[model samples]
Target: MIETMGDQLPAADIESFLPLRRCSILSYGVGHMLNDITSACWFTYLLLFLTDIGLTPRDASIVMLSGQVADGFMTVFAGELIDRFGRFKLWHAGGSVLVAISFSSVFGGCLLCQILGINSAALRTIGYSIFAAIFNVGWAATQVSHMAMVNCMTLNDTSRVALASCRNAFTMVANLTLYGIALAVFSINDAKTSVDIEDQYRWIAYVSILIGCCFVGIFLFGTKEPRLKQQHCENNQRVSWAYWFSKLLYYQVALVYMLTRLVTNVSQALLAFYVINDLEMAQSSKALIPALIYICSFAVSIILQEIKWNGWRLKAFYTTGAILWIFSGVGIFLLPSKIHNFMYLLSITTGVANALMTVTGISMESMLVGKDLNGCAFVYGSLSFLDKVSCGLALYLLESYQSSPSSEGCHDITSCQSVTRYGSGLIPAACALVGAVVTYTMNLHDTTPKSLSEPLLA
Candidate 1:
């Protein structure tokens, strides 16, 4: 069992804590990259793929929303399972296989529809939705188990940050690869028309499966979880649902982090629409925008580790990120239609902001929960649940609003940019503002590294 403050281990015993393992970190980081590659493929392409195949905007939104809801519920259940069973490696490996298979099934279902000469949009949408839900269940299990294992691997704050930074670096690589494939598959022809991408999507499925198997194999074989010192304490404690809910609601840092995650998801869901439909950019720009964002974020993540904040409060980072994001959001609204380059500038701003917020949010949560593995898993699960549900509802509303007859003028692109502006710009800005305000109100002071003796709730 890993020793935590709750374990009340003597100062001399601190040296007995498991040392950070570089090989384990590398394995986990690579697994995270693979996991995200598959996830990014779904989030960045799946809805657009659905619409391209025949579903209306609202139909696509409904499919994604259903998947998000299912994923949310599964996340809660998976968190409990992780806490109860302490089988992180098993869950991680099993969930990775499930995610790869189910994710491939989504594309396979589309292929089947095309092969069968299925012309009915309603029938295709139903088929796709079922596959999407199955994919989300696997995704929920994979993500929850993967995140929970991080804290279990190491209790040292510095080591944790190193692991997180490594993971973020892989995230950058994954984004690059993901967008590269998207650009190749979805590139426009000489007539400025998009090529048929259904076949290309099938190829993506096969690649994802291969990559998932290899990376998950690395994680399963390379990493080892230390024995937790609080095993007896956990065995004696039976936490109720009500208690979990109360803790989730009362935890200010977790709430703030959840809000940030929600905004990030909402922004992501709007990105392809904003670039392709609103900005009227070329298909290549879709890949370019995200690529630039990740590049800038990757740079910022590396720099953050070396730079000192110079007395700035932890909340200051959140506030600063929110303000930067707000500026980018407003920039999106004000950018002229003909100027595509300015979009790159906005992407950079948003990327830096995201880097700051994401690193700070994860670090803050770690500090708040200390070395409590169960608390860490539960908090992450709650955040995932809230982030998915909120983003789903937001997307449903945005898509429904855009699809209404009253918004038909938006089809002209020139006549009505309001829907796009609001969806991509004003709404995200509002969310950032709200997040900033809540973070400020938390009034948490920066504390030096110290032992935490009390339970997370206590």
Candidate 2:
């Protein structure tokens, strides 16, 4: 009896608790990175591209905001569908095809409108909005499916974190590389006196479509869902809709994450608008700024993983992130009006804060979710959806403020509107501070990194 009990002692090495189905994990990471690359290539440039194609600042705001509005309802409904379907590959394939076709069609339609002499400003706005809405629909659906795949890939927390780290690192690299390509395209166009509307404004869509198509095939070809090994999981695999509903009430981590995401998105969206319209920063410059931030964030994640924390793991991580945010806000407030080297410095500061917020936020969530990971992806999807809602609300509020006459900075960077714009960026930074405080107050039972008596390492 003693020998049997000893043999059955809980796993000491977290990594050993769940052996990685390595092939699946690798395929999953590569697929996710590619999808994000295609999606982000357009995502980072959507607002600027719309503005270039004759959409007014206000109209561009509406187009961006509309996607968020759509996401709110789509996340829950789509997540549920993914949970029930058990066919993530099909959705991945279908969504990729839709994305490719939708994106390619946008350019084709634009060329036709130009040739037919129907390229009026209103028509252009409508065309952009329609294409954006279609692209986002596929994006939302595929994201729900993708999250499900990630959850299914591993039950071990450390493995999942390692996977998340890989995904995020690649995501940053993809964003930087794609943005570099965009910057090159934009730079080339600016140097020439003549502008081909199609080349400058819509060719990236075709490129994104092509990249997405390749990945769709890769993901569909590579993955086969693993059969559940645990009796409890196998027995409960077909969780009823009512089960999902009832469990929703107890998802405290999900609620906290959603609120934090909402706050952060609102702040970031407004900041992007402010930087473009008020700061008058070049598109190439803006792309570079985010690249730097994401790189720094990737570094922070590596550091965060190695550090041994006790009671204050969550507290320390979030508090440091909050401080970076506030300091970055200060950088924004102090930036010189003339765009120059100081502008770059301010960008770096803001970028670092942004990275800290993102990486730390992700780590916190991973820690919070811990072992009960069955619906973790759904929680993530729902939080992402709420983030879009917050973005929508922020955009609406800013647009309203900009439309008003008394608002300063409406016409120039030196006005009250400038202040309003900067203020909006600071909102998320402030919220980060608040989130850190609230997180500390919560009574979460977190395991130390190395507990002598603990069974599993994760």
Candidate 3:
């Protein structure tokens, strides 16, 4: 290919073609900062906020499930539409607008109640649920479009991985920023009434939205839609969904991506409750511990950009992360409140595991998509459909049982600390283990006839 390029191109043409720049990398990296910030708020604080604001665990789970269900369906629709119509930036911008509004509504208290003068728990739950679903709809659009951009961004495998790593690094920044904001809010609030307490969350939501929107504007300005799409992106140029269904690699990537999401989302949702209720830690630990985790994740993500990636390295790093989570889970399950301080160490370990698994898992998806822009959005959207739904169901089941009268005779090995322990510990470990095993079996790069047996990976 290099020799062919040399033969075809004049010396002047070659030099004129410049490589991607540091500024370009920064622009691409922060493209999803809004999604990252809002998502961090969603997974880390949604349940805790709902329960604190007076909803039952079951009700809180319902709101969460509604959002997940809406998100799951929207991913397919959005992916199909983007593939057929091909306005990546239009979808991204429109979705960002929806997210900014609906996410604010989700945390700003029940719009219906505020208007109707009704404060009933059921009504508030329903109101929050509506906004949650709407927020997730927009979220699906943004996530699918941004992830699919990896293929169109560049052909170099290393460059592709760099984009993903930079994205992950921004995600860590977003999470940390959220925790810092939450810590400041929690630290300053001295509310005695339910109204004041609710206002604190409202303030947090508003501030987060403001910060996220500013970065989103930067992303919109700096990034350009792929020029190739304008010519090739026609509705008739379709790859049948069956094209993906027949590939074993499709299933492998889908499963690992789904399970990896489960590990991250479920554990994150439970982290606050685990620290506050299970360990009886300080109120600030809810924010502080997660901040610590993201700090470590941010550092690791920056480092991953420097490494040369490949199939074996991907699997090895992912497996190592999984093994670390296994150890973290065991530590969580066995450590007593007597040694709650040790939870900080476990948090650090979990952060490292998160960065490793998440970056590699997403890079694997990019590898699978490769140059196949025909249904690339469908690939990401379908996988995310699985991810959102599975995560929703898992959290709903766990939250529903967290405060059960019997809890089905479940023992905490010390004290019955509800389902927080299991959700934050056991479930993620098992999911990681399964994802790791599946990663081992994946044929990362295959060379064969493109018509009948084109391998997905590079």
Best by TM-score: 3
lDDT of 1 by residue, 1-458 (tens): 33554266655335423345556567777767567787777767776777666678888888888888888888888887777776776777777777777877676555445667885777777777888888888888888777766666656555555556667667666777787776766564222222245566766767766765776777777777545524523544634455645653336766677777766667776677678776777778877898888888888877665432211445787789899989998887767656767899999999888777776766665555445565556766777787778777888887776642233323333554556577777788877888888777664432223453222111
Please list the residue runs of candidate 1 whose C-alpha ends up more than 4 Å from where it truly belongs after superposition.
1-22, 108-118, 188-195, 229-251, 305-313, 403-416, 443-458
Give RMSD (Å) of candidate 3 vs. truth: 4.7
Question: On TM-score, who's better, 2 or 3?
Answer: 3
Which parts of model 3 have CA positions greater than 4 angstroms off? 1-19, 231-236, 404-412, 446-458
Cα lDDT listed for each candidate: 0.68, 0.55, 0.83
lDDT of 2 by residue, 41-79 (tens): 554556545555556667767766766666566666676
lDDT of 3 by residue, 1-458 (tens): 33444575554333212234567678888978888999999999899888877889999999999999999999999999988877788888888889998998888768999889998998998999999999999999999988887766654556667788899999999999998999899889965666676787788878888898888888889988865455444423677799889989899999999999999999999999888777778999999999999999899999988776667888899999999988987777666676789999999999999999999999889778765677888999999999999999999999888773342332346574568888999889999999999999998862111222111122
Highest lDDT against the true fold, candidate: 3
Ranking by lDDT: 3, 1, 2
Candidate 2 colliding pairs = 408-416, 408-417, 409-415, 409-416, 409-417
Any residue pairs clashing in model 3, and if so which?
none
Better structure of 1 and 3 per TM-score: 3
**330, model 2: CA deviation in Å?**
3.3
